[model samples]
Target: MSLSLVLLFLNFFTPQFNEAGQAKLEKMVKDRDALTAQWKASESQKSGIFGNRTKKDMIETNEWLERIIKKDNLIMDELRMIGDIETITATQTGDDYKAIAFKQEKDVQALKRAVAERDKQLKEKLSERRTFEWISLILFLISLGLGFVVYKKVIKP
Candidate 1:
């Protein structure tokens, strides 16, 4: 019965582990890596600015800063996405637990109901047995009394 219940529970509420989001995470990682490489290349180009810092060099540096800021934003977005996924997974797990708990509660209630019915039946049977015993005792006493009266009346006279 327990095994059947477990199987029924599993069959009813199978968890869906989402692997599709993994591909998106991998793509985000690649994008971050590519951005890091671009930032590093931009840093290496700073050697030209150090020799004769011109407006062009400053503008180039500004562009590099912008790229870095863009990368940071992308990283932040990725982190948010990961956070969202974690929250979703946690919520799903919590919901599953609640469902299991509810099912268990239902099972307990059903068992309680069955036990109450059985107890009621047992009490009824006991009452019936007691009634029959009393009837039997009364009949026996009446028969004994009648035999005694017959013996007294017949044998004495």
Candidate 2:
């Protein structure tokens, strides 16, 4: 009975004794490795916001809007030469549109600059975090190595 019990325990725990579990464990390990690789690749491609954003995330300014307004105003002014009624209506709407568009353009340009600045700050923060992680890993490994050395010298008889 004791021998049988020992055999059962070995059969349950040993990988070779449990081929199905062993295969499953190997597949799980492989899947875990694949997932880790994918995560790393994705992280490397990220703007550091959990890889959820794109270059559009960087555009938070209205300078571009101002540019568009200036361009549209030129075209609108040119359109005025084609008709006197159009010239008057264009003048009436032009100031209001230009003013509003200018403000909006400035706001958009400012927003874009702000988002770019935010991304730069985030990049610095991530760089610091990576440095800390490396330092900690190195320290952990050194401590482990020291502990092994101390154990071998003082405890192993």
Q: Which parts of model 2 are misplaced by more than 4 Å?
A: 1-89
In order, the Cα lDDT scores of the candidates are: 0.73, 0.62
For 28-58, candidate 2 gives per-residue lDDT tens digits of 5565566555545544454636666456433
Best by TM-score, which number?
1
Candidate 1 local Cα displacement, residue 110, angstroms: 1.9
Question: Could you tell me the lDDT of residue 114 within candidate 2?
Answer: 100
